[model samples]
Target: MSETSSSVLTRMGAAFGSMPPALWRLLLVLAVFLVGGIAGWIGRGVLAGPADVPTMSVYEDWHLLCPALKTKDGACEISQDVYEQRAGERLARIILAKEKDKSMVMYVTVPLQVLLEPGIGLKLGNDQVRVYQYKTCTEEGCLAVIPVDDQLLASLTKAQDAGIDVAQPNGKAAELPFSMKGYADAYGAFLNNEAKRKSWWRRLWS
Candidate 1:
């Protein structure tokens, strides 16, 4: 047979034009299947890939409440100035919270890779608190519960940020920043709550 050649599109169009209706339908169906298979493969590859890490926030769960925000009817209006971030897959968190006795406590939870002997160091402005002993450690991480006195509390409230310092076994140091966004307000609220609880207990017993 003599060879007959043309441009790719023209040759394809001619072949398709000369093809029987049934054969043309079969080719169309095969083309659709091929395209669909390629699309599905791409989708699966995208879905199975590693997910993107999220951006972490500095102030995570910092809130303040004070009696000054209370109304005249003996009901204190609570402010919802909350700043909190989810640790999720992240390593460490420095938490400042209040106890039942109105005392402030600082707790640091770090990854299991950290050394627990020297304790966790904390610094607020010019003041520094030495390594608070490690309380416990688990698969998640280690915990250091530091005692915060009135003087330290005052410094923390006035300072913009605090630092959690850790000394590695190799004598190197790692520092993490703790945001002081809503410290004063939260401390005020904690004191008010403690006072209210004490007043109620005294009235019940007396």
Candidate 2:
């Protein structure tokens, strides 16, 4: 053994370079890829939170029966005109079912003051002679925001004389503080908000 030369060491090292010997290297490469993929997947899951919905903003200058859009980052530019002529008429259904906030419902309440001068039949919580519109648009017939009170509905006729577009649609929609919901659902949202504001837990601890 003492006489053995260092040349034998080089030969021994070379012998280990066969195909089967490369098996360990291949296994290492596979393990690296698998681990990397799993890590990337986990990182993505952590980054995307519950409230995040991918959407672009919109810009809207003119509007009629549609909500205004602001400048946004998307392929399609949503306009007020397009929204009114053709948009998802299923607003109420979409809101009640999908809106994440359990405490409040969004409503677009058009005020009578904007169009009419005085003496309305229906009244809103704050304004008199009120009309709450439902977002019920159908192919044949669309639901108009009707004044709760019939007499107030009649009084709105005065707006017509003023040269204002004031034939109150039974379903009224206003940009100023406007939203759509079924009656029950709308009320429920209000209740939820009140409950949160006066939460029992907050009262007890505070």
| lDDT per model vs. reference | 0.62, 0.34
Displacement of residue 28 (Cα, Å) in model 1 is 99
Q: Each model's TM-score, in the order given?
A: 0.50, 0.23
Candidate 1 wrongly placed segments (more than 4 Å): 1-89, 97-104, 168-171, 201-206
What is candidate 1's lDDT per residue for 1-206, written digit by digit as tens?
Answer: 33555576678998889999999899999999999999988986776533322212222345433232222222222222212246435556656565556456776777777777777887787776566888998885788877788777678779876667776767687876666766676556656654654575534522
- List model 2 lDDT by residue over 146-205, tens digit each: 322344323322332211122344534333212221233333443353354355663442
lDDT of 1 at 16: 80
Best by TM-score: 1
| lDDT computed for candidate 1 | 0.62
